[model samples]
Target: MKLEMLDTSIFIAYVVGLLIIALWISRNEKAEGRNTEDYFLASKSLPWWAIGASLIASNISAEQIIGMSGSGYALGLAIASYEWMAAITLIIVGKYLLPIFLKNGIFTMPQYLEQRFDSRVKTTLALFWIAVYIFVNLTAVLWLGGLAIQTVAGVDWMFGMIFLAVFSIAYSLYGGLKAVAYTDILQVVLLVFGGLLLSYLALVEVSDGQGFIAGFSVLTHELPGHFDMILSPDNENYMNLPGISVLVGGLWVMNISYWGFNQYIIQRALAAKDLKEAQKGIAFAAYLKLLMPVIVVLPGIAAVILYPQLTSPDQAYPSMMELMPVGIKGLVFAALVAAIVSSLASMTNSISTIFTMDIYRPLQPNKSQNHYVHIGRIATLVALGLALITAQPLLGQFDQAFQYIQEFTGVFTPGITVIFLMGMFWKRTTSQGALSAAIGSAIFSFALKFTFPDLPFMDRIGLVFLLCLALTVVVSILTASKEGDESSNQSVSLDEVSFATDRGFNLAAIGCVIILTFFYVTWW
Candidate 1:
């Protein structure tokens, strides 16, 4: 793909304008009076709109824009289970998980674990998350962003990584989550608009200049097989998203771990002004998730019809973008860049928050708020620096970056999800049991991967989750305290009222479930 002068100018202007807007909104946060709460949690002052936009922006990145589209080209509509299932997952998290985290006034997921289990559990998971964010999550996003830039603008890969890292760190480091969340509002807008435009144009081209509706009709009628949401056992992509397992099995494990417990994605809701605001924000994000396939997945399907001769599925997104005219091309490119940078900023902020709050502050207690805030900024730089250095090598290991990310993260999700679920609902769960479950789950996941290399990764995750759940239960029962033992009551109490649902939230959640059900039934 070649970029003309006008396209280059517009892209540059869009990036500079974003930096200016983000910095301008965050100026107050960088002032002298800014403290730990203000920096790390945005002073817990974000409203529903900001929270919702930030959640979507943080969640959608090059992985979805590039990697998922690549999957769409290869695997077809079945790949959208990730996005569609996430809509229902967000609702579950809002109704069931957000209340618990909010009631505890926790700043991070590990902090909630600490309250439920012990410091050992908190510190262990906190370090684990820090390592994953820097090495896996952050590195993957940087590498994909660099690859996109290289594909679209013909830029050097290393330079592209440096460029994205610098812009993301610039506004986020000084202002923290405040800047990241607020700027995400604009990022989401650009992402949605640009993504839709790309899809619309791709469809138009595929239909030989006919409108989108006509193109869509042609696509469905001509490529009927590509529309299957449930894959058969003989299908090539069934291992990644197995037939019914996507609805009932390991996909749920992945979604719950990501939407409910992941620090980067959940931190937006944690920053909401109140529980009501947080739930509303989550519902709003669910609605956005419903629209994700239109922008992120459909273009890949269209590319199959429009550019059938292309050799690589990863080239689908860039090949489609190259079809756009000059000014529109720039806007769409800006949107892609927006998706990359917003996600990078969110991850960087979350890593800093986890390290500073969960690890550093606990080890060095009684520090001033300013001291912690300063340390957080420094930690942000270190995390970004490590990601810049390691992204290229780490990304080179996989042919499909999206599946690589999911498969690797799957190893940890089963154990983490089981531990969190038991710790939250079952008062009998002990810290020792939680710790044992965590360690055992990792070993079990690796054993399955190596021992049965041909087993579907999704199926392995399902098996691991069940095994870990049983392990947790047996360990908890054996370690239970005797009658009249005060230590037995030490577990965090689950307040029934915290899990209560209001009418508005209930209606919204029901609506989300209905919509998701309709999509699956219609597409099936």
Candidate 2:
């Protein structure tokens, strides 16, 4: 399974192309009157297309391109559930969540929390989210991207990790959200194209005797348990996690938290020019989510047929690239770099936003914009430095990178999701309640990870979410004001906004429900 040494030409092309895009966007970031709002929020004037591309690009990090593809290679098509179910989640967020945030003209999710709850609650959530955004999501992005480059190009993942970390910091350091969003359009296109090309080629290679449908048919039939919906904990399969219920449940909660509440991902939609563009952007990302499995997952599935004896599952992507023609290999490698930078820029901008607005401003008020933006640039470089160091160990343990990240996310997502939902919609939700819920949820997840790691992990997300919800309710009720104690300084009423999706979403939902049902029943 060993492949050729890294393709230097392709690697150089990818890195150079990304730098050009970032530099190109950098020119417009500091225009007169652009200020922080324009830089961070795209002047609140992004169209649906840009927002949509940014959303998908930021979401489809190297983790999904490499990790999810590896999951498909090992676990089969059922793993596509993660990408597909996300479509439904996006629709929910678009139909209900977008209007609330857009109508209020909020900047960060934590800013919304502050307006809805209190400063303490807002600051706590913002700080926690920034940590998770960097140490968690940002780390995973750099780790996976570096691993991919190392496998394909022998560039020393340590150096690749630094390259990604520094590149992300550079533009996000200078341009902020405008830079992040504009470059994301190019990244999104590259990711989709590179992935689709690889998958189509893999299918074509295998289907030489048979057609596309026939090749997959041969694979599904000849491969035992190829379509199995349920995997046993005791099964010797390398891909199976400890618990089925937990895996399914954990993934569902994680995706919801990411798509629905995460500030970094949702910031693009918030920057949309209007409600219509926001709605369109989110819904379009939803459609792209549905297509992700075809672009990403299917290739992993096809890889099993091409190189079945590889010791490391993560190598599936790199191995596939080796089989590609020389020029295409260079382009695909560039695409991988694009995917990595998109995530890096996104995380850097978000971390800067939370720190500057939520932390620096409140503690050190009356600072000049130049002074703060300077700090933001400094913070960007610092965050990138941290992210690079975090990925150092993961560079060698590519096999465990995906699992390690999931375990880390399992610790934070449940409670974070609950507090966000409550803060957004419930007028009764109190600052005390929000803080208490976060603390309780964190403690509960830590206990699970350390004390009872053998139990179902996904199932725990539901328990944690419910516990936070109940705790929030009790604390809020006890501290509930008779008058106006619940209102934050930025409160507004948007209970009557209407956001009707096209009939197409309904039809797609119906179609997906039926197809997923058939998949589960037949595979199980």
Candidate 3:
């Protein structure tokens, strides 16, 4: 996958073009009178298209491009359940979750917690999120991005890491969420087009240039094992994909935690002009999710057909790139870089937003909005710096970066999700009950990981979530007041109206479900 001189020049030009666009957009923000809302929430002015693009762009980072491809090489199309299930999750979040957050008019997820519970609950989870974003999410993106560039271009991994961090900060640090959201439109376009081109070229190579349909037929006929959408229990990777459990078990926990509650992903929907625009944006993103496995996952299966002798499954994507023609190689490489940088920018913006809105503002209340904006920019610099320093070492511990990320994050998501779901929908969940659930879930996750070493990570997450829910219920009943409960004042009322459905959203959601069902039934 080494680049020729012309290819190298194209790649360099693509990088420079992104910087130019970012700076041009940054100039739109006025120097003075820039408030916290302008910097953190894009002044709440993003349209549906931008929100949809930004959501997909932010989500499909090096993890999906590199790690999930690796998983595809090892686990087959079964791995695509993550992406397809996410489409369903996005619809659910739009129909059931967004109304609650939007109605409260909160900028951060922690703010919603404060409204529903107490400041202590908000502060505890906010700190937890900041730690995970810095140590896990941010660091993993940089490390995987660096590894991909090194594999394709022969650049040093550290150099790739720094380049990505600096490029993200250049636009997003100053212009804030607006800069990140607008530039993502270009990022998503390049990502989809470039990824599709790569997949098409690979299929053509596999069929010896007969055509896409012939190539696809050749692919499925020769490597029929690679098309399986479900894994049998006897299969070694069963715990990871586990046949029907992917539909009924902990995969739901993972998808809901990510699409419904994660700060970076939800921030785009939150920043939309209004509830209708946000719902529309989410539906648009849902459709895009249905197409992701074709672009991101199929190439790895193609590599299995074409380059079976390669030792590491992680090399699947890089090996596919080596098959591309000179000019197209660079274009595809640019798309890879675009995916990495867009995710980094989205994460950097979210880290700053959470820190300023949830952490810094509460410590020193009633400051000028401009002053808070200044603090946010500084927080972005610090977060990026921390990620650059820590990414490589953190990633070095894992053979498969994707699974490592999933297993580690799985430890926390179950507990966090329980607290949020109960707080949003139930009237009796006390602050003490929420706090106890949060703390106890972390302890139980770690204990389970060590105590029962053979338990699947997905099972661990489901089990932890149930335990947390039970604990919250018991603790709430014991601690509830005889007089009017104190927590009732802060409780969110979830009546039938709050989960109302519309024609457009309902149609789109049903379409996504039908398409996913068809894929599973035909492929299984």
Q: Which ten residues in a row have the lowest lDDT in candidate 2?
A: 238-247
Clashes of each: 0, 4, 0
Best of the candidates, lDDT:
1
Weakest ten-residue segment in model 1 by summed lDDT: 482-491
- Alpha-carbon lDDT, every model: 0.88, 0.75, 0.87
Q: Order of candidates by lDDT, top first?
A: 1, 3, 2
Candidate 2: regions farther than 4 A off: 1-18, 208-211, 230-250, 394-398, 448-452, 481-484, 487-492, 499-524
Model 3 poorest 10 in a row by lDDT: 482-491
Candidate 1: C-alpha lDDT:
0.88
lDDT of 3: 0.87
- For residue 386, model 2's alpha carbon misses the true position, in angstroms, by 1.1
In candidate 2, the residue pairs with backbone N, CA or C atoms under 3 Å apart (3 or more residues apart, or in different chains) clash, namely 6-153, 246-458, 246-459, 250-458
